[model samples]
Target: MNALIFPGQGSQKLNMMKDFYDEYPQAREVMHRACDVLNFDLKGLIFGNDEHELTKTYNAQPALLTTSMMVFEVIKSKGINFDVVAGHSLGEYSALVAAGVLSFDDAIRAVRLRGELMENAVPSGAGSMMAILGLSPEKIEEIVGNLNGVYIANYNSPLQTVVSGEVTALLSAVDIFKNAGAKRVVQLNVSGPFHSPLMAPAKEKLSEFINKIEFRRPNVPVVFNVTGKVAGTLEEMRMNLINQLTSPVRWTESVKTMDEMCVNKYIEVGSGNVLCGLVKKIVNAEVYSTDSIDEMDKLEGVVKNAEIAEF
Candidate 1:
């Protein structure tokens, strides 16, 4: 079976979907709808010269959603389909949209508020996230389990893990992590400490906003980040999304769960090939990413080949 995966933050780049927007009416329609829902000229910000503004938490959320949807529309039009869907962090919203669990309009608006709330969750310079290379997330968790203000944010891979916490705790834990065995500890350039206790306020506010929206059962099942498993029920899906705000992303486990579900092919439906790389490392699946027109052309051949192999 095949699964559609979506990437979250750290995968966005300037004018990412510009080619799609130019080449396909479906892609252009997605962007136009985003602009209407957002009530702002996202096209100007994304295609414009101000890249810094495009990457802001508030802006990036909707922009990524629109771009992912653009690619999704193009692929779906080409008859490409999937059995399940999953996403990383903010990418989860994109996944939800793909699964038909949430409408794009509701998702874009909610994530915009989610972004704003997360941006102001903690004071600037107070919260931060960092990547720990060549370290097991379990070992990293063992070392920082008792540390105040420090929490594991993403279980990205066997060799890569992310930590989020207060600046003071982050700085102090950096040395501890390095001394404990991390080969490299690089700080992430994100605005706030997401997926941690530090985001409680953001979670509270986002929950209030998201809960008001009705969540329908997905057309296809979704692998949630918190449990690294498929959602159990409709309310479970909604609850997982709200709980995701302050919970770590179990990316590695989620991929493993998908693998066990007989998903042998993965198509990353978003900007960069970040999720593709991560999926490759986790499983021996045929991984594909669609972020440009050329990649979309290549995807036609891939889907054909896969159908032949299945036949």
Candidate 2:
């Protein structure tokens, strides 16, 4: 079975899927449609030279969503079928759209507001995230357990765990982790401490917005980052998206859930293979990405062979 995984915030880059956008009419339409809904120069932000503007949380979230959907359209045009889907952090919106649980316009608008709410949740420079490498989650948890303001944000893998909190407290905890023999503790360049308690206010406001959007049952199973498993009902899925703001992303367990579902192939349907690389760390599965035409063609061949084998 094949699982389609979408990447989140940090996976974005300049002119993501621009080549596919130029070559594929379906991909082009996705971009054009996003431009209409966003009512701003989204292409300009993504394809432009202003790094600061492109990197802003509000801009980057919507841009990544649009690009992922563009890649999804291209993959669909090729007649590929993914049995399941999942995404990291902001990428969940893309997965939702892919599963037919949310419309593209709703997703775009939701993420734009999500980014803004998250951005203003805390004062600039007050919150931060750091990746603690080469450490078990339990070990990191035990070490930072009592440290006020420091909380685990992403259980990325057995080898990597991200912690977020007040900047000074986060920095202080970093020194503690480094001393505890962590391989490396590098601070992330994010504007706010996402997926942490600091986002409680954001979660409240987003809940009201989410209540207004219509949600449908997912056509395919969608592994959630909050629970690392598929939601049982549409209401649960909606609540999960809202609670995700203040919850740590259970990525490692999410991958394991797909493994349990016998999903042997993982196609990263986004501009970058950030999620692909993460999956490699967790499961022994064939991986592919839609980052380029060559990759997509290769994935199509793989899908063709699988279909032939089944026949």
Candidate 3:
């Protein structure tokens, strides 16, 4: 089986989809629609906007959504079928959109507002995130327990977990983890601490927004970030999405669950090969990214080969 995966923030780069936008008229139209919906020059931002402008939370969120959706639309127009879909963090919204649980408009609006809420949830410089490498989630949690206000935010893999919370708490935890044989503990450059109690305000606000929106049953099972389980109902998916703001992203667990379900091929459907690299680390499979037209062609070839093997 094939699992379609999407990337989160921090994977974007300038000129990410320039080739596709130039080559595919449909992609260009979708990009234009996104710019109008967002009331900003999204196409310009991805290709010509300054680096600093592209990094803003509000812009990054919607930009990624547009790019991911554009790629999905291209693939879907070709009549592809995916057994299941999953995404990391912000990519969850993209997965939801692809799964048909949320419309493209609603997903874009929700994510834009989500980014704002997360950015404003905590006072500037009060909280932060740090990546702890070379340690299991359990060991990271053990260290988190020793720190006052730090919490595991993104359980990325067996050897990678991002901790978030009060800066003091994170710093202290980093110190102990380094002494305990961690390979590296690097602080992230982020506006606020995400996926922790620091995001409670954001969670509250996003929950209200989510309740006001309509959710439909997904076309394909989406492994949720909060639960790492396939959600079959709109209500369950909505609650899981709302809770995701304040809960750690169980990405590693989700990958493992997909593998157990026989999803051996994972195609990342957006910018950068970050998720592709992680899939390589987590499981033995063919990982592909749809970042460029060439990559997209490569992915289609892989899918065709998979079909041939099945026959």
Candidate 4:
């Protein structure tokens, strides 16, 4: 079986999806629709020279979603399909669109608002996130169990767990993690304390927006970030999305669940290979990422080879 995954923030880059925009009309349509929804020149912002503006949370969210969807559409046009789907953080919105749970227009608008809300949730420099490498999740959890104002934001992989909290707590945890034999603990250059209790305000605001949008049943099962399980119903999927803003992304567990389900291949259809790298650490599956035209052209043969190997 095969699973399709999408990347989240930190995978975005300037000129992302430009090849699709230039070569495929369907891809260009996705970009134009995003521009119309957000009422801005999204194409310029994404493919233009201004890296700083494109990196902002609000811009990055919509841009990444658009790029991922553009890639997805191009691949779908070529008759590619998957048995299940999953995404990380902001990438979940893109996954929903791919699964037919949310329309591209609604997702683009919602993610724009979602980004703005998350960016403004905490005061600048008041909260932060850090990646703690070379530590087991259990050990890291035990170390931060008694600590206040700090929370695990992402269970990315066995060796990479991210923690988010107030600036003071984050700085303090750095020393404690090092002392606990962590290979490295470095702060992330994010706009806010995402996927933490600090994002409660953003979640609250986002819930209202989510309530307004119509969520249809997904065409395929979608593994959720909050629960690391397959969302069986639309209502459950909606709630999981709202809670995901303030819950740690159970990426490792989600991938493990797919592996347990006999998903032997993973295709990351997005801007970067970040999720592919993480999936590699979780399972010994055949993983491929298609972010550009050249990569997309090679995906069919790759999937075909994997299928032959499986049989």
**Candidate 2 local lDDT, 118-210, one digit each (tens):** 999999999989999998999998987889999999999889999999999988887789888899999999999999999999999999999
Model 2 gets an lDDT of 0.93
Question: Candidate 4's residue-wise lDDT over 41-126, tens digit each?
Answer: 99988888998898899999999999999999888888777989999999889889999999999999889999999999999889
Which portions of model 2 show Cα errors greater than 4 Å?
none
TM-score of every candidate = 0.98, 0.98, 0.97, 0.97
In angstroms, give how far residue 12 of model 1 lies from its true place. Answer: 1.4
Give the lowest summed-lDDT range of ten residues in model 1.
46-55
Measured by TM-score, how close is model 1 to the native structure?
A: 0.98
- What tens-digit string does per-residue lDDT give for candidate 1 at 197-249? 88999999999888899788789989999999999898899889999989999
Candidate 3 local Cα displacement, residue 217, angstroms: 0.9
Best candidate, lDDT: 2
Q: For every model in order, what is the number of clashing pairs?
A: 0, 0, 0, 0
Which residue pairs collide in model 3, if any?
none
Clashing pairs in 4: none
| lDDT per residue as tens, model 3, 24-120 | 7778877998887778788888898598888877778888988988888888877667989999999999999998899888888898899889878
User: Once superposed on the true structure, which residue ranges of model 1 sit more than 4 Å away at CA?
Assistant: none
Candidate 4 total steric clashes: 0
What is the alpha-carbon RMSD of candidate 2 to the true structure?
Answer: 0.9
